[model samples]
Target: MAAALGVLRRSDEGQSLSGAVLLAAHDLLYEQVPFPLGESSLCRLAELLVGRGVVPKSSDYEGRWYLWWPKSGRGPCRDCGKSRSLTRFSGRFGDDYRYLCARCRATERHVIAERVEQLHAMPGVQAAHSAWVCGPGPTGTRSAGGTEAEIPSAQEWSEYATRLHEMLSPLEWAGFELPEEWDTDFDRRHGGLLFETLWRGDGGVGVSYHPHEGKVVLGPFDDVAGQWPHSYSLLEDSLEIPVPGSGRQAAAAVEVAAGQAGLLDATHVYVAESAPEEARQEFTTHRIRRIFQPAAEFRRLPLNELLRETTEDHWLSSYLDWVVGRAGQDVAPDIVPDAAALGVAAWCWRNNTAVEAHHLETDVLMARVNIAVTRLTRQYICPVEGIDWDSIKDALMDPGWALPDTTPIHSLFGEGWTEVAATVCAELDRWRRLDHERLGAQTTLILMTIGGSTGYTDSWWGQGRWHSICRHILDEAIAAGLTLPAPYDRNGPEAFLADLHTPDRLSDAALDWIIDLRGAAFEGPRGLRMNRITRPPRHCWDPFWHSSTGV
Candidate 1:
């Protein structure tokens, strides 16, 4: 509990903990505390802490049981009427965040930029125009005076980011906005604001101000000098105030004030749609697509059809036939080989990973693979209890065996398991071509633990004598004249499998080659099932963590 609270308040302020977030923090720290049945179990637990004086309940929220949570937000914007996140309004605008919201600020900056663009090209005060204030302001700036001497503590700056939006946004947009995903830190750090009156002077002079850093820069906008370590300051005459007078004009107008604001290149706005999130999602989709080739026609291809059209590759043919026999009723176009076929495939997929010696800890790999498969396939096939022959057989015989709200795997046993187990073993046997002894040992273990039995898991994954599974798998592959690609184990199979149990020691580039060798991985199911996913889940694929758990 202490550790969880420490982590929650690590940003160094009384954190406004929501029921869900509070539970997550506590559960993460207390891994043994398996979540109770209700979604609000952890939330209700907060009442205990509050009642016992373990923590004080925040006045702002019933869920916020922190001793001293931060302020709500800048509040409803007097200008725009929307309570803006700090991304759009900063405390720098002063205690009340009086400055306009990001959009309103943009509208204002555009106003200034447009005015300058018009007057700089107009006759009379044909004086070149300048910007009054730009939204968010100059960003990604690397200038000097503004950053040379810092007045605030680094810890304090960190607090400012969280304090403003972490509190404000969550309190307002609770369900819609996630705390970690909020893009406020970059907004605060890369501040290069320009809030000077549009200069009516000629094009020779350019003005840039960084109020946050306490400095004003003056030079030609295109000066290659990289504004810094200034020898001159803002001159009284350099800054001339031009009033609203028709006659107040310069003798000659240079062209249009067409350049971007002195420092604002239009980057410092509050981009509600985060660039990192988009990029991460794109990369995930690409990685999944790399292995799971999209077959829009997959839904149309029935088990019977795919079963009928098989290659002499014997194993593919056997696997196809097994699918057809199990899910002949799944040919209804939308059902696509049916849910049982999916469940069987998932069970088989997990065993395939285990036989390949993917992870050091059997339970860890199995659970994660189960998660990945269920997510990828849209819960059509949930291999939640890990892999076993009985699970596969039930899925094969009963179309609705693993469908949503169906009987749990343990409770559903099948008489046809021996046949299914034998076929599964043979399919793995032909695909991997392991020796008789290696095949026999695994076949026995696989069958013995038919109906959700974990009896043999220790020998299968632990440091037992039989746990040379990684070594055995790799040894067989090498004997078959399958040497790794150049630059990996050029030293021979010994050096390659030397760190087999701890594959993470190998470099990432080496792991990519290893993954390619291990059938390029079927880490995810090809399609999503709406019954399975209602919200987004974070995915992180560690390139070198497994595929050895063979060594």
Candidate 2:
């Protein structure tokens, strides 16, 4: 009986056992094939197999009894056919061979399936998926960086002194010293601010408004090897100080950067004093706020958590809003939080969702392919494995579709899979295209390279009007030989090729304008896409993807 059940399990599509003497199971009993068992014996064996969970039972409505393996063990799912065994659950019928993968089982509920479909259909959802699958790459954000304000003239020295005085009280001026002759030269070391007073010796001091600390800082002249020894809290000066030479003091000095000053409180200052040999001084340190670093902020975006949600797009947008608000106002361009943090999160969420969608789509495509293969092979009495199903499946997943051995998969699986793979690939490509288009659409504050263009641009909006502005900005960034550091990178070249099928008159107009300006017409294919992008831009394009510079 177990032997018969094993044979039935290997059938894939399943086998039928009946009382009829001429049935296929009866032939095995006569030595016509293998497994010799009488007709009545086969029927009894089927009953025993069903009882032991070796084969799933068939409905009474069916003329013959159907036998299939138990669903509990690891193997391809009977429904979706996904070989990767994740959490499995039984179908409504029973806990037999008719089982589904977690996602497939979720579809048993019409509401859940509908919501999943709605989520897939949502604008920017597909884009997010593509971003996750590929990457958000190097989208820059507004961060706390050095300001490029015009160098203050000698006449402005008094005003600078007044601002500096606001940060320091007459009491803490004990060891603090100011230089007599203020250097008006723009120095990159002190946040591009001209020195109010220049210290002559090797241990010369400098001053700059700290963007992250929101206070004034006085540090060593050679910033690389030295420290900013002091940071002041202006709003409420219950004088917070750092122990003269502690690590925190050193950290405070380095964090002081040039940017628009923010409001500071008593908590912003830390002070400590080391006790001599006989006296052990208690180490008391005050922590006001974390010194902000864009790279550190990027690490904290919670991208993985966002990707786990069904509505990842909404969550990512909300998170970006929160980050922007937390960043606060009048932040110098250099010191603003990297605006690209939102895009990075969005990219991760989208990539994760896209992977899920890909697997789901693969199951559906493979099911159809399997059905066709089953019908054709059964008619021709051929081996199923002979059909190159793996090749077809791989092609469906590969974006490039450049299988090393391009020997037609159609020959092995028949022409049916060719259409199926093509259809699935086309659908997947749509999401990929959305992801590319959504890139520069997300944030305007940072310079980015939009679409398939080779140059970097400054335009924040995706509209045709803004594209021209972006093109000009790209030229400017290039002309200035600007290269960003760390979290920020120059908007380098991309594999973007504009979707020629875009329905927007503005997009078309913008293309036409480019052709006229450059005196070069784009005579390539219509509705053509290069690289990962697949379709035309949608009519209702959000210039900044869905992010606002509000925060």
Candidate 3:
């Protein structure tokens, strides 16, 4: 009871104790109790604690009890109206809590970049072709006076040419030709151009390009709009215009620059009825013929589909089909082959890490044990007398029999509560160790048959931008009441807590742990039925994360 209250009292958001909050609270009490205590059971324990006055409840108005933390005097931020606990920068932003959340700050930066793009596209600022790198801003390098540093080497054209070439190289795959005049102008003008990227405490991004010796210096619209002028003529002057896609093709973008350079075949250009006025006008200016095609048809074909279709007799596809069949569903498109691929890839990646063979074997077992516990607690609840032990053995060996439920246990058996709990506990522990042994003996070579660890690990999970994403995923799952199994070994607690504070480590380790848990848990006769399963999304293939060489 005191343990539960200690957790609740530690919350920065002490308004409501959710399942995640309860789990996090329970984790915070690791020193007092080491075993895995389920969140529902802990909630029940909290009820007992509050009613007995062992842990005083601050309020019961929100359908659940809440305890206020003395230091949790935080509320909505004054600027962004977001609930934040810590103040990022204090007096500079009036009040510290008045500052923006990480996301809002990030958006502000993107907006700044966008505003800069709009400013550069104006007629007066002559960069020829300037684009705002969308999404989040990089950590800006600042001068001693706190202003952003200038783009050094105005006399060095080679450096600028290399950078321009690097950025433009990826577009070559779209089957377009670059104008000789455009390339020449880019090379000649590279040295005399100043590329300035500015950043604000609220994460606002502002980028500008001007002649190295030119008088015009553009910045954030609000900061320099009065002195600066907007030129509508430049909108039509730029060669390459990148249009962000929408709907099913949200992560893809179409570069309309080639048409302006006379590289687009008029017969190949088609504008849909849904194409915006701007796109239509641009298409018209380029003398491109229009055919109405659905936006869905314009989407880039998925790389996975292309690869899978091209590779004849791919062992990976065959394995996926087998796994899907085992899951009680026919191997079909709706099952998301990518999810299975990612799960297998993550497993292989973890195997390559320095973790010893013994530990790896133990982790696999613990994962199975976790599944058993969840099944016993949630799926197979029944009294000792009512549960068919022989049926359980048969079910474990075969996939047909249903696990026992709580109703049968209570209705059929009135006594032996302690004995029932003990019996199941022993059985789960035994299976947990055996499953570990079973998995340790299996080959990890199947992972190599897929895209291997390269696509799954290096792209998303390995990237710094995706560092906090695992925490986001976990938080989402916990909020949705998805319970994970407890650690099977004594050392399991530390492994679970490893990298909890570091986002990258947390993400990598969390993915490894979750996959291991799912692989073992779902390995039962009823395969992969859990709704709240974690997997990488198609957006993970966003071009923003990639350069010419790839992420």
TM-score of each: 0.18, 0.17, 0.21
Off by over 4 Å in 2: 1-335, 338-341, 348-350, 354-508, 511-551
Tell me, by TM-score, which candidate is best: 3
Q: How many backbone clashes does candidate 2 have?
A: 33
TM-score of 1: 0.18
Q: For residues 96-149, what per-residue lDDT tens digits would candidate 1 score against the true structure?
A: 223344355445444544543354456743321111111112231222223332
lDDT of 3 at 212: 27
lDDT of 3 by residue, 372-398 (tens): 322332222111111222334333333
lDDT of each: 0.31, 0.28, 0.29
Evaluation by lDDT, superior candidate among 1 and 3: 1
Q: After superposition, which runs of candidate 3 have C-alpha atoms over 4 Å from their true positions?
A: 1-155, 163-460, 463-465, 468-551
Q: All candidates: CA RMSD in angstroms?
A: 26.8, 30.4, 28.3
Q: Locate the minimum summed-lDDT window of 10 residues in model 3.
A: 287-296
